[model samples]
Target: MLLKGKTVMVTGGSSGIGQAIAIGAAREGADVAFSYWGSDEGALKTKEAILETGQKALAISGDVALPESAISFVQETVEVLGKVDVFVSNAGICPFHSFLDMPAEIFERTMRVNLHGAYYMVQAAANQMVAQKTGGSIIAISSISALVGGEYQTHYTPTKAGLLSLMQSTAIALGKHNIRCNAILPGTIETEINRDDLADASKRSYMEARTPLGRLGKPEDLVGPAVFLASDMSQYVTGASLLVDGGMFVNLQ
Candidate 1:
């Protein structure tokens, strides 16, 4: 129960990694509230999972790409879950497209959702923590793409790298208020977003073989790291990037 008595808020939590972290916090005895962008069924399932853990659950439907939406999501969470002890920025989209043939609209939307959305959400969450007068943790769901490259992620990688940079800068700005900021770099997690990409047998095997650990990651594999970042266990850790890639990043050969 590392998060006992704490209230955790998450964005893009209707499914995938975000949903896993939200429920993970609940399992650790924290009240969990999350923002989802119109995934009613997914949101309901996430809420049910959190409730089963005997912790409070709040499902907020809003677009993180809008600044006011992010602000209102925070306000609503505080009003319901009490106060935010930890905030996770996990809302993002990665629309795979060849660099040479990338559509301007697709690239722009990616920037708006992944990069701009995170900026707004993080700012809103930090402001609330400042008002609370208590130290808090902020975690961003950055990816290994921040360190490497992807052929179809030309428009996506930059945003993740931006997230890594965001944590570093915010760590300095928010440290005075005792607010800690960090990013998680996960590698090849099998989620809905990449299901089609990994569906090819050879592609999936190549990806798995690239990892020294011999497998791709599951959404739940990230829970422990997210919990660590959100809990006091990482009290002294800030402005850091935790790479949870199953040794893939090191298997350059």
Candidate 2:
């Protein structure tokens, strides 16, 4: 019950790390609200899992890239689940494209979804947290690529990098209000988006060779860190990027 009586909003909680984090939050005794960009199938499944932990759940559908949508999500979540004590900005996209071959539209879309969307969500959530006069936590799901350069991921990397800065600055600005902001930078997590490709032997080998742990990460691997951040265990933590990459960055040669 690390988060007992807390209300948490998780964006893109349909699958992957987002889903795991949502479930983890529920298990920690927090009422949870999660947003999905696509169908409710995945979100509903996650909601079911969360309810099994005996927490109230809300699986909402909306596009995070739209500022209005982000604002509405916050308002709706607050109305349904009460005040948000933790906000997890997990909505992001990574459409791989070579720098030279990438289209302008691709870059714009990535920035819209990955960077701008999270910014707006934070803004909306911060307003609520401040008004409630209760200390809260804001967690951003970034990527290790933000710290290291990656091939064919220029757009994705830059946006993740922006998240780090956003978290840092927000933490500073909100510290007096007892609101903490932080980011988690993951490396090569196995999710639906890359599951098929990672299953291939050659691709698997490439990822294993780079990670010092000798394997790609599972989506659930991010849950523990997320729960710690959301709980009183990390009350003194803020404006930090916890790289849960199994030493992938360190092993890079």
Candidate 3:
């Protein structure tokens, strides 16, 4: 039980990586709270799973792109779970679009949800941790897209890169307060968000072949790394980007 009696709040926990992390934290003995923009069924399932682990769970409705929603989400988590020891800024969107003729709305929406949303959520969570005067952990669900270029993700890549940058800067800013901020760069986890992109059998097989691990990632694969960051295991680690891509990023010649 790495986080016994502690509280964790994650954004976009209705499904995918976010939902997995939320449940993983609960299993480690932390009270889990997640803010979701959609999927009532997913939210209920997350809550139930957490409770089954004998930990408290809270499901909040929020759009991380909005500053107030971020604030409210953090506030409610504290109101219910007392204090936040770990905060996961995982709410994001990536609408794949070509760079040659990207729609302004898609680009704007992607940035707002991925980058701006992280900014607000991290700020709100950091403020709460600072006020608590207790050191905490902040994890951003960045992507391998941050470290590499994506032809169809010109708009999406920048937002992920922005999240990685945000973690680095925030780490420096919040280090004095003992708040550790880090980013996790997953290569290509099989999630609904990118199901369409990988639907092409050729694309899927190519991606699998490109990775040194010879397989795609799963949402559950991130649990261990996230737990390490959230617990005392990473007490002295901060401002770092942990690549959980199963060797995909390093396979390029």
Candidate 4:
């Protein structure tokens, strides 16, 4: 029970890595609150799973891309679960498109959701934590793409990179307030969003061959890192980027 009596707020917790983090936090004895953009069914399933752990859970629907929605999401979570001791900004979108083929609208949308949304959530959560005089943790779900350029992710990669910069700046700016901010960079994780991309034999083989682990990662692989960052174990860790990439990023080739 590393997080006993704490409250955690996870964005996009309806499924994938977000879902895993929310459930994992609940298992560690933290009350959980999460947001889903469009999947009511998935949200319900996440809530049910959290409740099964005998921890309180709240799931709301909202688009994090919008500032108002992001702010409201945090406010609602605090209203329901008390105060947020941990805020995981995990809602993001990745659309593969060559730079030449990327449309302006698509690029803007990607930035709005991945970068702008994270900014809004972090600000809201940090404000609450500062007001309460309780130090908190803010975790952003960045990507390995932030470090390595992707041919098909020109637009998406920038958003992830921007998140890294944002976390760094936030860490420095909020350290005095006792709020820790960090980014988690996951490699090729198996999730609904990237399932089709990883299903191709060639793509799967390419990823596996590049990763020293010889396998793609699962959402569950990130649960431990998320819990660690959210708990007291990472009190001294801030302004850092933790890579959960299964050694993929180390392959120089």
- Clash numbers, per candidate: 0, 0, 0, 0
Question: Listing every candidate in turn, what is its Cα RMSD in Å to the true structure after a full C-alpha superposition?
Answer: 0.6, 1.1, 0.7, 0.9
Model 1 CA deviation exceeding 4 Å by range: none
Clashing pairs in 1: none
Residue 36, candidate 4: alpha-carbon lDDT: 91
Q: What does candidate 2's lDDT look like per residue over 1-253, in tens digits?
A: 9899999999999999999999999998999999998857898899999999999999889999999988899899988988989999999888777898899999999999999999999999998999999989999999998898978789889999999999999999999999999999999999876676677898889888989888889888998999999999999999999999889888849
Candidate 2 residue pairs in backbone clash: none
Model 3 / residue 9 / CA error / Å:
0.6
Query: For candidate 4, what is the TM-score?
Result: 0.98
How many angstroms is residue 50 displaced in model 3 relative to the true structure, after the best TM-score fit?
0.6
Report the Cα lDDT for candidate 3. Answer: 0.93
Worst 10 residues of 2 by lDDT: 191-200
| Tens digit of per-residue lDDT, candidate 1, span 17-134 | 9999999999999999999997899999999999999999999999888889888999999898789899999999998999988999999999989999999999999999999999
lDDT order, best first, reads 1, 3, 4, 2
Clashes of 2: 0
Would you list the clashing residue pairs of candidate 4? none
lDDT, residue 15, model 1: 95
lDDT agreement with native, every candidate: 0.95, 0.92, 0.93, 0.92
Measured against the true structure, the TM-scores of the candidates, in listed sequence, are 0.99, 0.97, 0.98, 0.98
